[model samples]
Target chain A: MKYLFSVLVENHAGVLARVSQLFSARGFNITSLTVGETEDSTISRMTIAVDGDERVMDQVKKQLNKLIDVIKVVDLTNVPQVERELVLLKVNATRQTRSEIIEIVDVFRSKIVHVASNELIIEAVGHMIKIDALIKMLKPYGIKELARTGQVCMARTE
Target chain B: MKKTGSEIIIDTLLDEGVDTIFGYPGGSVISLFDTLYNFSDKINFYLVRHEQAAAHAADGYARSSGKTGVCIATSGPGATNLVTGLATAYMDSVPMVAITGQVASKMIGNDAFQEVNITGITYPITKHNYLVKDVKDLHRVIKEAFFIARTGRPGPVLIDVPSDVQKASCEFKKITNVEMRSYNPTIKGNIKQIQKAVQMILHAKKPIIYAGNGVIISGSQNELKEFVEKSGIPVTMTLLGLGGIPTDHPLSLSMLGMHGTAYANRAIQESDLIISVGARFDDRVTGKLDEFAPHAKIIHIDIDPTSISKSVNVDLPIVGDAKGVLKELNKIIKKCDIKNWVDYVSDLKKKYPLSYTKSDKVIKPQFVIETLYDLTKGDAIIVTEVGQHQMWTAQFYKFQKARSLLSSGGLGTMGYGFPAAMGAQVCNPDKLVVDIAGDGSTQMNIQELATVANYQIPVKVLILNNGYLGMVRQWQDLFFDKRYAGTCLGRQKNCKPVCAGPDKKCPDMIPDFKKVAEAYSVKGYRVDDPKDVKSVLKEVISIKEPVVVDFRIEQEENVLPMVPAGAPLDKMLEHGLS
Candidate 1:
C-alpha cells in the first residue's frame, strides 16, 4: 500500500540527508518526497510518499519518528488532503503543432510557460492524476525534456 | 566571565558531572586540550595512544559504570578512527557522547587539511549528532548530546565542533535540562498490554522469559528476579544481556542464540509463552525466524518502540522500560503454577550441560576461563574481544550481577577488550578488571599497553593465544570443508620461492606477546600447561600494575553447542565430537 507522511523537521543543514538516509539505509522505498520551509523558520515541512506493506510502513513511521531532527510525522494518506505536484515539460511543437498543444494545455487548465520556434514549455499544477494526464496528452508531440517536483500537501479541511 | 569555546566545553562538562574523559590531542583540538590541561584538577583526561581506543575506552566506561561515557578526538582521520567504537556503542545502545574537532568554520567545505564532515559520516551510527558552527551553540549542543545519549533507548551521540569554535569566546551558561519536543520516549507501559501479558504468563503451561540489555540498562535485575520467582518461569538472556540475572540461579538460562546453551534453546522452542523483555529478537537469538519460538506467543516489553515486532512478531507489545513494566506486572500478578515447566527445563539443563572436549596436554581456553572464574570467585569485571574465546568466556564464566560481563556483543569488534578493560579499571580502581583476549585481537591495539602501564590501571589482559582467529576458523571447519584461508594469524604472506606451502610450515605464533608486554613496561606471563592456568590467573589478579598473561591454548578448539546460521533451535550441535 502507498502511504503519504507529512513530516516536520528541524530546519537546519543535513536534515534532508538524515531523513533520506533513514529511508535508504533501512530499505524503505520512497515513492516521492518534497521539502520546504514551514510557517516557523526553525522548522521545515516534508511531504513524503512511501511505498510498502502495512508492516514496513509502520516500521518506517516509527523509525522516522526516532530520528532526533524529525519533529513530527503525520500520516496524510488517510486524512483529507489537497495534494499538489508541479511538472514542467518542453515538448516539440512546430508551428503546425503549436495550436493543438495550446488547446490541450487549455483543456487541462495548464499554461504554456515558454514558447520557441519549434517547442513549447508547458507548466502544470494539480493532483498527481492531472499531471499524469497532461503528460499523457502531450506524449505524441515528443517530450524533449521533463522535470517534476514531488507532491506537497496540506489537510483539506483546515 | 567570558570563556573560549574550549572553556565553555569544560564548564558544561563539569556541570554535567563528568569525572573522566578519554581523549587524544591533535592539531584541530589543540585549544581544547590546552583548556583541559588548565582544568585537569577538575576533570581527569586520559591521553589515549589511538583515537579508536579513546572511543572504546569511553564505551567500556559507559557500559560498566551505567553512566554516559565521553571521549574526544580531532578532525578527519582522528574522527574517522572513532567510527568503529561509535558503531559498537550504538549497536549495543551504550550511552556515550563523542566530541570531535573539525576544521575551522571557513575551511569546512573547502576540503581543508584534516577537515571532514564527521557528523555527516556518523549519521547512521549515532543516535544524534551536531555540528556546532556557532560558538554560542557549544553549551546547547554538548548538553543535548549528553541528554540524547542517556535518555530513552540510550545510544552514542556525536558533536563535531569546528576548530574556530573552540577558540571563539563566549559567556559560559549551564544548560541543566534539554527538552526536545520531538524526542520524548514512552516510559510507562499501557495497562491493557500489561494485563494481557500478565494473563498470558499466568495461564501458560510453559512460559519462559527472554531478556537482554534493556533489563541491565533499566537496572531491573531485582524486579526480574522477583517476577521470575513469583511466576516460576525460567529466563534466558542474550549475549549482551549476561549478568542481568546470575547464571547460577535455577531459573536463569545463561544465554540463548547461535552459540547459546543447548537447554536454553530447547526451552525457548518448547515454551508456550515467551516473555521477551528488553531483547530485540536479534537474528542470532532467533535462529531461523520461521522456526523461532513456534509454539510460543511472544510478549515483548522494550523501551524502544522500533525494537518491538522488528524480527519476530509479538502477540503483545508493551512499550515501556523493563523495570517499570515489570514493577506494574508484579503489582497485580499472583504466583503461577509452572512447577512442571520449571522441572522440564531443569531436566534439559542437566541432560545437555556445557561440556567441552578436554585437552590435557596444552591448555584449553575453557580451562583458562573456568580457572579465572574460580580464582576471581566470579567477582571480576570480565571484558572480552570478539571471537571463539569470547564465546567461551560467555559460556564458562557465570556472571552474578549486572554489568559484570562487558563485550562488543552487537558489532563484534576485535581489539575491544584490552582498552575497554583499561576504561573499566579507570572508573573502578578497587574492582578486579580482566580482558579475556584472543591473540589475533590483542595485537590490534597492543600499543595501549603504554597507556595502561603509565597509569597503572591494574587491568589484566588474558590472551588465549591460539595462533588463529578461532571463531572464523570454527565456521570454516564446520561449514566450509575446513578450507582455512587467511584465518591463520601466522600465515606467511606472499610466500617466497623457498617458502613452504600454506598448510605445513607457517610459524605457529607471530610476535611473542610476553616480550611485547615487557617492551611496554607492563609485566607479562605465559603459561602453556593446563595445570598452571589457575595459579597464573590467581597471581595476575593480585598484581597492582597492568599485566598480560598469555595462555597458549589448544589452537583447534571451537565454541560449541553451535546453531548453524539460519538453522532452527533444535538443530544445535550439542557436542561437536558426538
Candidate 2:
C-alpha cells in the first residue's frame, strides 16, 4: 500500500538530509517527495509518499516523529483531502499538428506555456489521475520531455 | 553577561551541575581548552590519551551515576575516534553529550585542516546532533544536547561547533527553560493500556517479567521489586539487566538469551505469557524469532513505541517509562497464582545449572569471578570488556543492586571496560571499581594506564589472560573446525614468520602486560597457579592505586551453556567437545 505523510520540520540545513537518511538507513522506499518552506520561514513542510503496508508505515510515522527537526507528521491518506501535481510536457509538434495540440490542451484545461517550430511545452495542474489522463492525451504527439512536481496535499476543511 | 562561546559552554556545563569532563585537546579545540583553564575552579577536566577513551569514560560515568556524561574532542581523526564510543553508548541507551570542535565556519566546506562533518558522521548513532555555525546558538545547543541526551530512551548527542564560533564572543543568555515544539517524550503510560496490561497479568497462569537496562535507567528497581513480589512472577533479565533484580532473590532467574542460563531459556520457551518491561527483544535475546517463546503472549512495556514491535510482535504494548508503568501496574494488579509454573521452572533450573570443570591444577575464570564476588560481597561496581570473561562475570557475579553492573551489552565493544572503569571510579571515590578484562580487549585502550598513573585513579583491571581471543576461539572450536586462524594472542619462542607474516610481531611476551603496567608506574601482579588466584586478587584489589592482575587461566577453555547462533535457545550445547 502507498501512504502519504505531511511532515513539518525545521527549515534549515541538514534537515532534509536527516529526513531522507532515516528512510534510506531503515530500508523504507520513498515513491516521491516534495519539500518547501511553509508559511513561517523557519519551518518547512514535506509531502512524502512512501510504499509500505500498515506495519511499516506505522514504524515510519513514529520514526519520523522521533527526529528532533520534525514538528509533526500527519498521514493524509485516510483523511478527506485534495491532492495536486503540476507537470509540464514538451511535445513534438509540426506546423500541421500545432492547432490540434492546442485544441486538446484547451479541452483538458491546460496551457501551452512555450512553443517552438519543433515542440510545444504544455503545463497541467490537477489530481494525479487527471494529470495522468492529460499525459495520456498528449503522449500520441510524441511527448519530448516531461517534468513533475510530486504530489502536494491538504485535508479538506470540515 | 557577555561571554565567548567557549565561556558559554563552560557556564552551561556548570549550570547543568557537571563537575567533571572527559576530553582530549586538539588544534581546533585549543581555544575551548584555554577557557577551561580559567574555569578550572568551577569544573574539573580529565585529559584522556585518546578521544575514544574520553567517550567511553563518559559513558561509564553516565551509566554508573545516572547523569549524562560529557566528552569533548577536536575535529577529523579525533572526532572519528569517538565514533565507536558513541555507537557503544547509543546501543545501550546510555545518556551522553559529546562535543566536537570543527574548523572555522568559513573553512567548513573548503576541506580545511582539522575539519570534519562530525554531526553527519554520527547521525545514525546519535539520538540527535547539531552543528552550530553561529556562536549565538552555542548556549542553546549545549543545553539542548544535555536535555536530549538525558531524556526518554537516553542516548549520546553530539554538538559540532566551528572554531570561529568558539572564539566569537557574544552576550550569552542561558536558556533556563527549554520547551521544544517537536521534542517531547512520553513519561506516563495510557490508562487503558495499563488496565489491559493488568488484566493480562491477572489472567495469565505462567507469567514472567523480562526486564532490561530500562529498569535501571528509570531508577525503578524498587518499583520493579514491589511489582515482582506483589505479582509473584519469576523474572529473567537480559545481560545488561543483571542488577535489575537481585540475583539471590527466589523469583530471579539470573540472565537470559544467548550465552544466558539454559533454564532461563527453557522457562521463556515454555512460558505461556511473557511480560516484557523496558527490554527490547534484540536478536541476541530472541533466537530464531519464529521459534522464540513459542507459547508466550508478549505484553511489551517500553518508552520507545518503535521498539515495542520493531522486531517481535506484541499482544499488548504500553508506551511509557518503565518505572511509571510498573508503578501503576503494581497499584492495580494483584498477586498471581503460578505455584505450579514456578515449581516446573525451578526444576528446570536445578536440572540445567551453569557448570564449569573444577580444577586445582589450572585457574578457572568462573572461579576467579566467584572469588571476587565473595570478597567484594557483591558491593563493588563490576565492569567488563567483551569476551568469555565478560560472560563469566555476568554469570558468576550475583548483582544485588541496580547500576552495580556496567558493561557494553548492545555493541559488545571489547575495549570499553577499562576506561569505563576509570569514569566509574572517578564518580564513586569510595566504591571499589573493577574492570574484568581479557588479554586481547585490555590492550585496546591500555595507554589509559598513563592517565590512571598520572591521576592515581584506583581502577583494578583484572585481565583473564588466556593467550587467545577466548570468545571467538570458542566459536571457532565449536563451529569453525578448530582451525584457529588469527585468534592466538601469544606465541612460543622460535616461531616462524610463514603464517604470522614478517611484521606481525608474534613476540614471546606479547608485550607482557605486567611489564607494561610497571613501566606506566602502576603496580602489576601475575597468577599462573590456581592456588595464588584468590590471594593475588584480594591483595591487588585492596591497593589504593591502579593495579593490573594478569590471571593466566587454562587456555582453550570455553564459556558453556551456549546456544549456537540462529538456533532455538533450548537446543544449547551444554558441554564443549572434550
Candidate 3:
C-alpha cells in the first residue's frame, strides 16, 4: 500500500538530514519526497510518499513525529486531497517533428517553455499520472533530458 | 552587566540549581575553564580523566539524584568521546546535558584543528541540540537545553559553543522559563483509554505487570506498587526496571528477558493479559517476537507514543507519563482474585529458582555479589559493567528502592560502571556506591582511577577477574564446540588458537590490575581464595578512599538458565545443573 504523509518541521539546518536519516536507519521505503518552505518562514513542510504495510507505515509515521524538529505529521493518504507534480522535458525536435510535438502538447494542455534550433523544452504541471502521461507522449520525439519535482499534496477543502 | 559567553553559561547553570558538573577540558574550552575558576565557590566541577567517563559520570549523577546530569568537553576528539556515554543515556532515557566547545566560527567547516560538527553528529542521539553562534543566545540556549533534557522522556541534549562565541561578550539576561511550542510531551493519558484499560484489567485472568525504566524515570514507584498491590498482579522488570518494585516482594519477578529468571519468562509466556508500564517491548525482553506472549493481550502505557506498538502490537495503548497513568489506573482498579494463576506462578518460581553451584576453592562471581548484598543489607547502590558479571549482579543483588541499581541497560555499554560509581558517590556521599565489574570491562576506562584519587571520591571497584570475556566465552563454549577464538585475554604469542582451558601455564593477566591501581595512587587489593572474599570486601568497604579489589574468581563459571539468542523465553538451557 502507498501512504502519503504531510510533515511540518522546524526550518533549521540538518532537520532534513534528520528526517531522511530516520527513514534510512529504520529501513522504511520512501517512494517520493518534496520539501519546501511553508507559509510560515520558521517552518518547512514535507510531502512524503512511502510504500509499506499498515504496521510498517504506522511505525514510519510515529518515528517521524519522534524527531525533535518535527512538529506535526498527518497521514493524507485516505483524506480527500489534491496532489500536483511539475516536470520539464527537453526533447530533440526537427522541423518535421516540431508541429507534432506542439500538437501533442496542446492536447495535453502543456506548453513549450523554451525552443532552440533542435530542441524544445516542454513544461507540464498536473497530478503525477498526467505528467507521466505527458512524458510518455514526448518519448516518441526522443527525450534528451527530463526532471521532476516530486509530488506535493494538500487536503482538499470539503 | 556585560559578560562573556563563558560567564553566561556559569550564571545559567547556577540558575538551573546545578551544584556539580563532570567534565574534561581542552584548548577549545580553555576560556570556559578560565571563567569556571572564578566561580569555583558557587559550583563544583569534577575533572574526569576521559571525556567519555565525564559523560557517564554525569549520567550516573542524573539517574541517582533525579537531576539533569551535566558534562562538558572540548572540540573534535573530546566531543566524539562523549558519543558512547550520550548514546547510553539516550537509550535508557537518562536526563543529561552535554556541552562541547567547537572551533572558532570561521574555522568550523575549514577542517581546522579540533573542529567537529558535534551538534550534527549527535542530532539523532540527543533529544535536542543547539549550536550557539551568537553570544546573546547562550543563556537561552542553555535554558532550553536543560528543559529539553529533563522533560518528558528525558534524554541527553547537547549545546556546542564555538571558541570565539565563548570569548564573545554580551549582556546576560536571566531567563527563568523556556517556552517551546512544538516540544510539549503528552502528560495525561486519555480518560477514555484509561477507562478501557481498567475494564480490560478487571476481566483479565492471568495478568502480569511488565515494568521498565519509565517507572523510575517518572518517579511512579509508589503508584506502581499501589496499583500492583491493589490489583494483586505479579510484576516482571527489564534490566533498567529492576528497582521499580521491591525485588523481594512475593509478586516480584526480578527481571525477564534473555537472562531473566525462568519462572518470570514462563509467566510471561503463559499470561493472558500483560499491562506494560513505561517498558518498550525491546528485543531483549521479547526474545523471539512471533512466539513471545502469543496469547496475551498487551496494554502498553508510555509517555513516548512511538514506543507503543513499535515493536509489539498492543491491544490498548495509553500515551502518557507512567506516574499519571498508574495513578488513574490505581483509582479505578478493582480487587480481583486469580488464585489459581497466582498459585501456578508461585509453583513455577519454586520449581526453577535462580541458583548456582556452591564452590569451596575459587570464588564464584555470584557468591561475591550475594555476599556484598548481604553486607550492604541491600541498601548500597550497585553499578555494574557489561558482561557475565553484570548479569550475575542483576540476578543476585536484591534492589529494594528506585535508582538502587544503575547500569547501561539499553546500550549494554562496557566500562560504564567505574566512572558512574564516581558520579553516584559524588551525588550521595553518605551512601556506599560499588561498581561490580569484570576484568575485561574494568580496563576500558580504568584511567578514571586518577579522577577518583584526585577528587577523593570513595567509590569501590569490585573486579570479578575471570581472565576471559566470560559472556562471549560461554557462548563459544555452548555453540562453537569450545573453540575459544579471540576470547582469551592473556593468550601469549606462541599460544595455540584452540588452547585448553585456563591453567597455571597460561600467560599472566596482562598489565596487572593491582599495579595499574597503584600507578594511579589509589589503594588496590587482590583476593583469590573463596574464604577470604567476605573479609576482603569488608576491608575494602571500610576504606575512606577510592580502592579497587580484583577478585580472581572461578574461570569457567557461566551464567545459568541461558536463553540462546533468538530462542523463545521458555526454551531456556539449564546447562544440566541441578
Q: Model 2: per-residue lDDT, tens digit, A1-158?
A: 88999999999898888998888997987888999999999999999998878887888789898998999999998999999999999999999999999999999899999999889999999998999998998889999899999999998989
Root-mean-square deviation of Cα positions for candidate 2 versus the true structure, in angstroms: 2.4
* Sort by DockQ, top down from the best: 1, 2, 3
Clashing residue pairs, backbone N/CA/C < 3 A, model 3: none
Task: After superposing candidate 2 on the true structure, give the runs of residues whose Cα lies further than 4 Å from its correct spot.
Answer: B491-509
DockQ of every candidate: 0.88, 0.81, 0.68
Per-residue lDDT for B309-368 in model 1, tens only? Answer: 878888999999899999999898888898888898999999999998777797988888
Question: In candidate 1, which residue ranges exceed 4 Å CA deviation?
Answer: B493-508
The sequence of per-residue lDDT tens digits that candidate 1 reaches over residues A85-147 is 999999999989999999999999999999899999999999999999999999999999999
Give candidate 3's TM-score: 0.98
Q: Which pairs of residues collide in model 2?
A: none
Q: Please give the C-alpha DockQ score of model 1.
A: 0.88
User: How high is each candidate's interface RMSD, in Å?
Assistant: 0.8, 0.7, 1.4
Model 1 clash pairs are: none
Summing lDDT over every window of 10 consecutive residues in candidate 2 chain B, give the lowest-scoring window. Answer: B497-506
True contacts kept of 2: 0.76
- The runs of at least 3 residues in candidate 3 whose Cα sits more than 4 Å from the true structure, single-residue gaps closed, are B576-578
Indicate whether candidate 1 or candidate 2 has the larger lDDT: 2
- Report the first chain's TM-score for all candidates: 0.96, 0.95, 0.96
